[model samples]
Target: MTSTLSRAIVNYPNRFDPGVLSELPEHLQETIQRRNNVLGPGYTLIYKEPVEFVAGHGAHLVDRDGNDYLDAYNNVPCVGHAHPHVVEAVARQMAAVNTNTRYVQESLVDYAERLLATFPEELSKISLACSGSEANDLAVRVARYHTGGEGIIVTRWAYHGITREVASFSPHLGTGSPLGPNVRLIDPPDPRLAAPGSTLAEHMRKQVRDAIDDLERHGYRLAALVTDCAYTSDGIFTDPVGYMHGVVEEVHGAGGVYIADEVQSGFARLGDSMWGFSRHGVLPDIVTMGKPMGNGLPLSGVVFRPEVSDEFGRNVRYFNTFGGSSIPVAAGAAVLDVFEMENVQQRVLENGTALRAGLEEITKDSAYVAEVRGSGLYVGVEIVKDRATLEPDRARTEDVINDLRDRRILINGTGQSANVLKIRPPLAFTSDDVTRFLETFAEVAKDRL
Candidate 1:
């Protein structure tokens, strides 16, 4: 990295400066513009205007124009953008050792043990894969093989990955059977629709019970429940905690495995815990993790109950060429170290509290804003046509995302309807950053939302 980039970290998250990109060599500018053109027309957190990135440091993303963006959309940079500690660890390991799973790599073994240390005791065996999709597929295989069942249940607006098998379990297709039969679907028990005295947890329990019964009647005993710890595809934090406990218990009671899809909600992003399942106080039989695992590296895995692994082993040969490869292990080890030394999770808790409060403050007395729900750095601002009606104003939500980008702030949207303004910033996001984002959001909403 250049000294200019080195110096940028000291004053992170500064307002993006278009001049930096302008100052790029003529060829680079042409290439950047061409690249922007290639993206064509699309709803995105970024656009052609002032679009270019040069460097990153800690909690900021610097465009080619040297404009620093407060990184609230990058979990891949969990230890913070281009963290030197992780870079150095990766470099040293790459220089010394990096090989396939066929070798005796200490990094892999060490990382596996360290990773397992953070999981629940019941989760004792792990199988590494290259991406969240691969991990999800493996988890499903393990679940079905272990349970000797063929059914899977997922929530509406659920996203596992792009793999064919995982895709079959994903509700991203919404109104299609492309995901295969025997895959039961249900809505995430969003607290907004709750009865006067029904707790979110209790409501989810009822939903899980009903789904299980319906699936059983259809001659399909569930093999597993694959769900984002938070149903993040619907929105950032669906607060799947209380409801998750019920889901897991129900799955186990039905002789199915509870597969926690921690691809989005793991590694302390929720704060106060390493895994999202920990937040629910229930141990899942299988846990599929990715997203922030290697902080953006192509690495993911499934951790399961030992008995399940033994059962799976009896049926299929478990193998992946790059599973737990040396580089991923090195990067993962560094992430774990950073998680401890920097106390990143604790920082998430602190900043999460501040950010949520700031968002709530912006929505106060506003007709455009409905509710702000989430935990830790992962959050969602529900845009509504009318708060009392709980209707999603999709167009206005899109406008909010566009306007935020126009103002040089980075953010995005989620949900099947694409209306929840998502705030899943990197764990390194700070209070001042939160204040700035909310201030811009409030300003934008006052004018258009």
Candidate 2:
């Protein structure tokens, strides 16, 4: 039987399928050739009609051919593409002074202070890194030191980062890759898997307990249970968010830490709260965030309890050359400023509510759409061959994605079968954008299905 978590994750294409790009325009063809020549191997573009974005503003992107596209697939530009506030802050800081953390930079300190304020008081210490991978790697180190354990637990198909150690914990990389000796895999808290009389919380607790037992049997003590709070890459699982409380307490009981990888769920992207962990009413011992942190600039970090870091600091020293440097720090600070100035979280709630309602109505009578669900701006439309059986339809999902691209709307499919359409738009996406997206989506669904 296919696990619920497996059904939720989209099977990312590893090899390029040339069939989709066969009829590209001459100009795009030439551009693709040039890119291939310069960019070595292992490159994959999103759509069959790959876009060479020349410029971006608000929630849209303009390709080299001057064709405009609604960019609903990018969250790195959470404040919208080329947001003036963040761009200006980065440029101004770069012009003034761009240096490492060794120097006394007031802006860096101020940004750290501002960012820390959003987190709970218990997470009093912060350490900046350049990407989600680095932050997570550091988090693993911190957990190991704090607990004197080598075991780590993650969801079966969880994706943490690209580093060697992190990759060992991310099984989604594939069967060819080997996992770390001390790492354990657990099924995500899928609501569908809950037994008739039990809750999702109970199912998840049992899963975590089983993982802990397995790790212990391997002669590895539990160090941490790292999870993507939104389960973004394992398929966006956001509902009855408080179900993970038992899992967290279980980690604590086993003397393991809970590390929340918020690369996809932080900074008001979830709409309901500032952090996804908060939505679940759980406080992580270590929280690592990236992607939207600097709003395009390279800035990610780990936020942890002061005492935890104190011990790590006493035993081992840590520093990153450009981790919390001047320019990225400035950009980070600007992101927070934009969040407040524009009232982003509340706006996300409004936009997400509208998008969800519209999607539910549009896909209600569809034969392929199994479910329409998600939180805030992050939405997923599950595509199935038969609504009654709920069997995934990857072929139809791929066709829908291409058709949406043809209509100038951007979205992608996710889940193990790549059957769920992911609709995570920028935080600044408006009511008008929502209507346009839904109209285009309905048109595409009608024509394709």
Candidate 3:
């Protein structure tokens, strides 16, 4: 009963119903009751009610009680939820061929080649996976095998995936989580380290150099320096183009691979570039992606320089049952088609500039807002306890989230202390939406701050 209501919450693809759905049947009422009993009488009871959602289309979600909401959280609805072209493509493919990896199918090969063309010419090979985690997990295995190394270096708060080995790469585990051996932690780039008159790119390069040097001195063979291009977890970023070059080169100097985790940062979310790594102006040996591809269908892959996989193939074998399934490939293809036809990236680029301007204007008077960082559609409003202390302000951040919900704007918080309001709406999100969000958000934030 509780899981049913939880599914009701999870399955809602758009704006959630603002009010407690009083029209629910007795069975759904019991489901909501059990949900409250298990999950406790918290936000869901008051601000967010447990309402069964029926369906979605474009940027709106309708519940069993029939309420509409402007979606700001879903990127997988790239061409808008239940896009007709995408739906038709999936239906056609489902009717034609939904085969496994064992077959030499056109859908798999065509989609693979199409995806590869999106990357640099040097990226010659691609491997299929079902999710971002699977892609990262596979990259880890390949990198370790290719470099013949044991140590892996990653960001302190980065999220790679849910699988066992990749979980070791994520330091968000906190106090009691189990972890793998040889995973080294590092702080995300602090502006203080580089300072004024110092180049951020060079600073990042120097830091990676120090990390590799320290690892070698400690008798650890470094295999890879894996990170999401955006530094999503650190809540901060090193600036300027090619900020990652020195680091990637340093990893190579230590005979390690440089893997770009593009699951969250790719598909033109950055606005200025097709891939997040493109903004860095450096090529990654391996690039993995998911979340937006297949327009919410479980389809993802790793694009790598062909030689990396060839070297690793000597020791390991990999295969996924549904990585490039017929339906998923069709969905992915439809996404590509929509991107080209709609020119969504161009709109995102323009909208991103507008969004940043609005947000900067929104938080100008708030002392709690430490910094606003990120580009394109992904923006992070960093919150601190005080300017002097720079401590995490989790409680105040929670209150602001509640306030936003009260205004019916669906936004959430992320980063180390869960203080930064991580904002990345769908590509379909407009300037008007940005303005509305800013108005509501500023009003909500002013109260809490």
Candidate 4:
């Protein structure tokens, strides 16, 4: 059993190192040098070999050299890479006109109406932005203004975004990066990993209350509790559905808003539902979504309670230059249209169920495999050196990931120790993709672990 304390304090190790590019192909080596000179060291690449892809089509990516790798890791192109529907919509819109939000755009309101319909009635207003970081920044400002408070709560390993304001909410950036003085970190609920006799619901309530109390003790008013619904950066704990209800209640009781960061978990990524917060059976005061909204395009925003937005609108003059503009609007509308016409939610649900089953079966035959858990298409496979001790096998995890990459199967590791394989493919991933992934994964597990 995983202790709550251990889970909260777990350190996220650096998974990819640019130094490993020593044995890279000559072209990639030259590309890396160019990237270092132009893009700087801040940018990161995946895999030991560091692939340079040229094109992607429906759950598969073609590298610069024409090698096709099965993509089991990218969620930004939610529906599928270069999906004709989204492509056509964006191109058609751009060909006609692509302007700022100040213009009268029916597509903007149309997309907003379609998106707002997906949320609970309370989340009746929308404000668009260019990325998740911007949406989260807006959410924090709205929360602070509405509650007249400055404190924020987040999971110890949570990652909201990269902007200066949002980065303060992302503790996963590690110790060198200081969180805002008003920010507090809490442990997320994990049903599969909680220690014996410890109920996740009760533990979460206690932790939330303690966090809020700590905030007040520090002379800060409670502004909001922001959480990524899937807990993606906090190790993908999606089990024990409705576990978040208690936390939400605590936030409301404290007069603080609850902001659901659904950038990685929204758009039917979790299956059966279009949004991750829906899985917890609790509604947030404000919900932020991005990444897949425009299917690879730069588009993100927040949807909040009408009253909250109304109040903010009256006081603060808020306007994003390119947000909710022509191209993103058309692309977002086409994504919604594709979801309806293609029944993406139902398909993802079915595929996810099959994936979990396959992974669970595979775990039984592997010594390094400790657990296989997730909802919809976002899954995590825990790699451990000792199943009895639950000690993470980071070395083995890295080996498996690189080996899979070598075999033309793309995936990555996540969690504090980077020992849990993060498997989130495009929504269009089919049964064939699953078979290929499982077969390749099993081979790597056997050979490397």
Give the range where candidate 2 is weakest over 10 consecutive residues by summed lDDT: 1-10
Better of 2 and 3 by TM-score: 2
lDDT: which is higher, 1 or 3? Answer: 1
Cα error, residue 285 of model 4, in Å, equals: 0.3
TM-score, one value per model: 0.87, 0.95, 0.87, 0.95
Backbone collision tally, model 1:
8
lDDT of 3 by residue, 1-449 (tens): 56644543432122235344566567776776676578743134322333355777765666666776556556677767888889999999988879887887887788888888889999989888889999999998998888889788887777788788887887664433344567777667656558678777677777777777777787879999998887776674524566677888888889999999988888898888878889878888899998888888998889889888886766667878899778888999999888898898997899878877888888877778888777888887777888667787866766776677656565566676777776777777777777778788778876887
In order of lDDT, best first, we have: 4, 2, 1, 3
Summarize candidate 4's per-residue lDDT along 330-400 as a digit string, tens digits.
88898898899999999899989999998898778677888888899999998999887888988888888
User: Model 4, stretches more than 4 Å misplaced?
Assistant: 1-16, 192-196
> Residue 340 in candidate 2 has what lDDT?
93
Tell me the number of clashing residue pairs for each predicted model. 8, 6, 1, 0
| Clash pairs (backbone) in predicted model 4 | none
After superposition, the stretches of candidate 1 with alpha carbons farther than 4 Å from their true spots are: 1-50, 174-177, 195-199, 238-240
- Runs in model 3 deviating more than 4 A are 1-29, 32-52, 193-199, 236-238
Per-residue lDDT tens digits for candidate 1, residues 133-206, read 99999888888888878889888778898777887877664433266778887777687656789888777777
Lowest-scoring 10 consecutive residues by lDDT in candidate 1?
A: 8-17
